[model samples]
Target chain A: MAEKIATREAYGETLRELGHRLDKIVVLDADLSTSTRTALFAEKFPLRFFNLGISEADMIGTAAGLAASGYIPFVSTFGVFATGRVYDQVRNSVAYTNLNVKIAASHTGLTVGEDGASHQTLEDIALMRVLPNMTVIVPADARQTACAVEAAVEHKGPVYLRLGRSKVPQVIPPGLPFEPGKAQILREGQDLAFVATGIMVGIALQAAEMLDQEGLQAAVINMHTIKPLDRELLAETARKTGAIVTAEEHSIIGGLGGAVAEALAEDYPVPLLRVGVKDVFGESGSPQALLDKFGLTADNLAAAGKRAFQKKKG
Target chain B: MPAISAATLEELRLKARQLRREIITMIYRAGSGHPGGALSVLDILVILYYKVMQIDPHNCRDPQRDRLVLSKGHACPALYAVLADRGFFPAHHLKTLRKLGSILQGHPDMRKTPGVEMSTGSLGQGLSAANGMALAARLEKARRRVYVILGDGEIQEGQIWEAALTAAHYRLDNVIAFLDYNGLQIDGWHRDVKSLAPIVEKWQSFGWHTLEVDGHDYASLLEAIRRAQMNKGAPTMIIAHTIKGKGVSFMENQINWHGRAPNEEEYTRALAELEN
Candidate 1:
């Protein structure tokens, strides 16, 4: 076990460090600079940063305008406001024309505890991935968050980068290379495959260790890029393991689970179990309590792996 | 005030009339497009394209060029007519308004249409985008300007105020907007619906350089734009008062014409009126 760091903190540090190198990079936040960590960039580049005062729709539209004028704009806000509150602006202004705008959303999923369902965005991944010309990325840890941000800057198009509020363990080694739509296979197995994203990647890897003790060799995968999904990796992993379990800190309907299922159902049909929030709204609770209540724990994922394995055997 | 000669004003008026006729024919051909708002905003578009805006059809993508955003995109028939007349595309394409696979879509799409700066159909968004362009111009230290046209009814969306505050906060003097104050909307009169009365005052209070003018009058529109450019450190808003359907005798100020195409006889009658 190593020290934990929040992905949002990593994003802030990365943006500030990159701000000095990239002059064309402009950042906008909806009065959430302190919370979203855009304040770090704002402090360095005061002229390039725009604080749009709690108006998400206007913030998105303004970012679209900035992008249209040949500046790469990274818009920062809470996940719920960035996607649901301002969905039309993102769709029409940004995604429709495929502008070079990056929507970096923090405080996503059930881990945004105490704010409850209103603040927690469990469906942002589905909302964003459904749009054409949108790249969806959910980094597993602080190191990966930095990679995702830098990648988003280089990748020219609309991207939805999901970040978290809670501190999570360092799952990936520092400075691991990150490609836009590639998934990383962290652990190898044979009986079943555990596909996870965001915070759930660490949980899935822990669950793999638990399953390994029971003579069940479950492969663990970190599927960070949900859109332009690493279909080749998923297809190969699904074929190798007859059963699959998908884990995410989001709703099972349209989040990581849904994306994996769509791919597996299309390429190779396998007995699969989706581990996530079961289409129910989250309530105010501690992050650990919410994870335990919503069946997003390592133990829950291991159980799901066994269920998928048994179903495949049956 | 730069004295626009009577000859220039009259020529603009005739050109606007011809464009108005084109708008009628385009909507009539399309069979299902907005005609009232199109006609209401025709003269403003005409003046900007022909006289006010510094744009060349040959070098439209030039970085230093002035940009125009038709925020009230339902009025795109007017914009399309002007763009065609300016030789951005063939005038024959005017007949293909709203046609399948035609560049002229129901709403303004920048990717589809030439000389269109920003793709806007939903209201209350253009100003923020215009602000972005203005900011970009400022950042680049270019003398280019960004102009946007918004409908009175479209201002009901809350995003407009957000943009207003942003433009003033950023001191985007390079951006200018025209609020097409045509009384009619799709449902009814804007006064009876969501009244934006004390509108100029609202913008002035929001730290904009506000002006009022007759939208149909070419000279007045140009003069207002001149004043807007001189007022530095704040974005300008020209509340140009206009009739719903200005050229056609029958459709003038009529609410029903807001979204309906003229019938065959109505089209013939409208054309005859514009010609007169």
Candidate 2:
């Protein structure tokens, strides 16, 4: 039976584990402790935690300095503030110099609930993934978010880990080996493929089941690492299933949709349908209501998969 | 604790003169570099790299070694010259500055260049980076200190104050920042462009241990740095007053020379004046 786990909870647990093991791992937050779930780490290790007010740029710059001095600094904030607010600091102090800092951003995409568009970061993955030497990870659920946080600490360079705010259903089992630049094939089918990332992974899995009822077998692959993007898995899946539907909670431009298009355009050209927020801002609503309003639900994924299949048939 | 020897101070002054000449030569070779700020900061760079900072070029990556960040990065020609002269790299590589595939890039690249502590060019950022280093050093119980040089014009950025508040909030006594108060920026005089007057009062008000000194006076600069190292509970700021173009008569205090390398005739005159 698949258990439902919130990525933020997993992150909190994983941080506590890492904190106990590694004495040099310090956690810094921009006053969004409960929201980002860094309070878990703070509770266990009071001396190591630093609450840097609401200054995102200072948090990143400080992390860079800490990384320089041989400590692995995990700076957490909301996805919108972490990426959009302090982009220059991250670019200059972290990515440009290749510092060993991990930015764990929570409340990403429309799943952030009533906080709405200003809080939601639909373009974070696009912004972070485009920077050289920056590893971008979007875990499927809480369990996977924990796994991704652990993996990011071990990775040698800067990483941007995107997590959702709402309680998401955990599709991946606990103790599963999570590695960077590798994709997890949740289910295998031949007729069509539902490629997804982040919280949309569970939605893609549900959509696969719905498509199965319609006599179309839809394969599901969780492309967590957006930059090193599992090109081999995508290429082989495209060869097997003549169509692909990339589902993400980000903008269609320069995101998972764009990554899939770039991979397929070069290796294997397939009929691709991007299921994401069009060029529009989100609004104040519940997580489920916003998912429906933005066409990011499992039903939307099924529709997009069916449309992609029909285009392949033509 | 006492004053530095007179002979040693004179030797450092001569070395600063030589460093200014090297800055001119490198910029002239590149045909494009920030000469005004580089010349202005030559004395401060000479004193820190040669006499003040506890560092070794041979063991450049020594964890316990003192760190220096050139926050006023447009003036990197002088730093590149001084580091090369210190044997961080071969002195000959100075000629390849600003060229394709050269380690001597327009700005300092910490990865490419030895003895360059942090990669900085964007203003109002290096001090914040230094604060992190200081905080980390404290966390690890390390005794190494951090120094950052900022441009007077660069202090106009808001992020500098953000870093200022942070450094004070953290009480990072292990960090000391130097402001190259040459009074001129790329556009015009700093007073005309964006006045950072009462700069000492500003730093003092921000809770930093503040000191004002003639940047060209190696002894006073060294004493100020010593006082900063001895002080505890807050970071220190040394507001270094200097001439924009220190050694060259024609380029002295001229804002046009901020980014421009001297032509053949001017370079010849500048080199002769330095030799004399």
Candidate 3:
């Protein structure tokens, strides 16, 4: 098994190192510094770190003010509070104002586990991507999360960096440069392609290995940036593979699956299957149990690929 | 705080009345806007732009200039009139209020309008932004102050209390805020809908230095601002008691005029009443 690191852990670590180079970076958290790993940065830059104390809306609005004052603020909190609880603040104060606020939300999707549906955030992507000036990113591994942190700080305007609590296999190389709106292809195949994001990328890579043994070649592409959907790359990959399956640990209504489906429908129509949580709420369980229950595994991904194979364009 | 000279007081009173006329006429042309709140808050804005804030129209982007966030953004017609009068842009731009492609949006948009700090319309978010500006000032070792204007009804939002705690927790003394207590909202009287009585006590308990004053009186407002500026540890909240639709006789204290533009006859009468 590959070594694993939680993207949230990597994010906190990345901000710690990046803080040395970037003097303008200020950190804000809504009483979740320990869980979200923002404590790492707070420990180093005590004056620069502001613990806003369970006020998500206030945290976001304050970050916007700092951004207006020429400071790049990275606000950290759980995914639910970061997106739903402070939606209007994020919409009006941050995104609409076009301020440079980085909302690094941790513990996303069913993998948040045992916290149940209330704490788990399966709709953060849908919420963040719908805003006009918001950029949404889902880094698949620790190395990718570090790159994404640098990219989000350097890129102006609002950015929502979705992160997770559980550690996942490291698929991205440490030396590779990452940019928003660009897609990374991990494996190239022709029979079917799996477009995955966040932890699902590692799952998709494992599924491709499973499919290779069964005489079906599957390609794994990481659609890390959800908002700018890399339409050219998605179209080309779809054309080459003929069928595609989008996987995410989120609701199928509007996430990586929904974005890919929307882009493909407009630019390139193809037979596609979305492998994600169907229209249902999650429940309290261990991370592994929840993954197995939601069919978020290599076996389930390989099955989704086979199903896409049967979905011929009639 | 020292007493204002008779000349300065008379000048400020006359200037406020002129801006009231502009606010009424601009909304009447747009055919729709929040006249009541705009009129109620116009005097407070007059004092800030005319005397307190250090701003230059030519160098509007100066980082040292004191910032103001209109938390109650529906009152932007008043702000636009003041911004234009201050030469942030051409005075003729006030005629283009609410029109398509106009820099003056229905709400205050910083990206569109000059001299506007943080783009604000949604209630209960301004105090946090002000706290942010104050924090940034403290970080940079700059002495710039940040002012915010909020509506009485707007404080009903939970985020306001959330931000109230933030300002106090951070000790953002540079953040000075005013609550335009016109006693009316879109639905009806604030007391009848949801009372914020004991409002001063609320801010006091929240770790702010609170002052209650007459909204329209220039002396009382200026005194409160002076005391607030001298305050050292906490943000100050000035509860300026005002009548809804203050300047116009028919509109004064009338909830019916909360969001409507004036008709021709009402416009004529309004302009006549404010005429010297």
Candidate 4:
């Protein structure tokens, strides 16, 4: 049975587990400990938790220095400030040198709700994925987010774990094994495939169910790792399904949708429809309103799947 | 075995002089490098590497080693010279500075350089990095100390204060930061460009144990570092009052020398004056 879990809560729970195992693991937050759910780690290991105020750049630089000294530092901040505001520090101090620092950025995509475009980082995935030696992970939901955080701690080098702020409906079952670069096949279908990451995974699953009701079976694959993208799974899915609809709660350009297209274009050319935020910034609105306004709801995914299937037929 | 040996000071001063000469020659060869800041910081580098820091050039990656971060990284010519002089690498490799394929880049690269603790160029970031190193040492229950040097102009960056506040808040005594109060930057005088006046008080207000020192005076620099080591709970910030270009006569306190290499005639005069 598939268990429902929120990614943020899972992150908090999993970090506590990792904290007990790895004494060198320290958590730093930019005054959003409670919001990002890193407060859970603070509760468990108060000594290891450092609330670095609201300075994201300083937090990253400090994490870099700590990593250089052989301490595994996990810095948590909102996606907007972590990537957009501190690109130079992340590039030079962390990624350029390949420090053993993990940046767990929450409030990713439009799902962050009323905080709006100023807070919504639709381009964070693209920004972090482009950097060399940076492992980008956008887990499906809370259960996977927890598993991903655990996996990231074990993986060497720098990893950017993109997480959502709001309580997302969990689609993955509890205790399911989560790997970094491997994609999870939720439901297999012959007509088309809905490949998604982050919050879009739930929407993709819903769309798959809707397509099944219409007598056109659609498969759903949860692609959590965006940088070391599961090309093998993408190729296999494209070959099997013959059509792909890549969905994400990020910009259509240079995101999961773009990564899938790039992979398919090179190895397996397939009819694809990218279901995500258009090339535009979001506005202040509720999460549901924002998803509807941006055409990123399950209905949009279903329509995209149908379109991709038709394109394959043509 | 004298506590204050004139012969030992004289040898360190000679090493400083040699390092300065190497800085001039390397920059002249590269046709581009910051001469003013490099000359200003040469003495401090010589004193730290030779007499102050607990380090081994042969075992640069020793976990228990004291770390030194050149926060004012544009003045890397001086750091490169001192590192080469200390035998971190061959002295002859200084000629290939700023050239492609050489380990000695325009800015310090920790991976490429033998003894650089962190790759620093963007101002005000190094202090925060140093704080992390200090905090990590404390967390691991290690006794290693971290020393960072910053340009006077570089302190204008807001991130420096952020790190400063955090260090003081955490009471990271293992970290010591030195401000090269050269009063000059790439554009012009630090005061004229952006006033960082009452700098010592500002660091004190930020909760750091602050001290003032004559940066060019080896005894004062050494004394200040010693006092900083004795500080128990708070991070130490030493305001090193120095001339922008200390050794070269015409270049002293001159803003133009901040990033300019000495021309043939200027280099001849500067070299002769140092020899004297």
Stretches > 4 Å off in candidate 4: A1-3, A173-176, B1-3, B263-269
User: Can you write out model 4's per-residue Cα lDDT over B1-276, one digit (the tens) per residue?
Assistant: 126479887887887787778898899888899999998888788778989888988988989999999999999999999888887898888999999999999988898989989998877789889989998899889888999999999999988988988999999999998899888888787778899978888999999999999998888888888899999999999898888888888989888888877888888888887872
Pairs in steric clash, model 3: none
Candidate no. 1 TM-score:
0.98
Report, for every candidate in turn, its global Cα lDDT versus the true structure. 0.92, 0.89, 0.92, 0.89
Full-model lDDT, candidate 1: 0.92
Predicted structure 4: lDDT? 0.89
lDDT tens digits, residue span A37-74, model 3? 99999999999999999889999999999999999999
Residue A228 of model 4, lDDT score: 97
lDDT of 1 by residue, B44-68 (tens): 8988888888999988788889989
The per-prediction tally of clashing pairs is 0, 2, 0, 2
- Local accuracy of candidate 2 as per-residue lDDT tens digits, A70-180: 889999999999998888888888999999999999778998879889998999999998899999999988777777888898899999998888888778866767888
Once fitted onto the true fold, the runs of candidate 2 whose alpha carbons sit more than 4 angstroms away are A1-3
Interface RMSD of 2: 1.0
For this target, which candidate reaches the highest DockQ against the unseen true structure? 3
Clashing pairs in 2: A6-A142, A7-A142
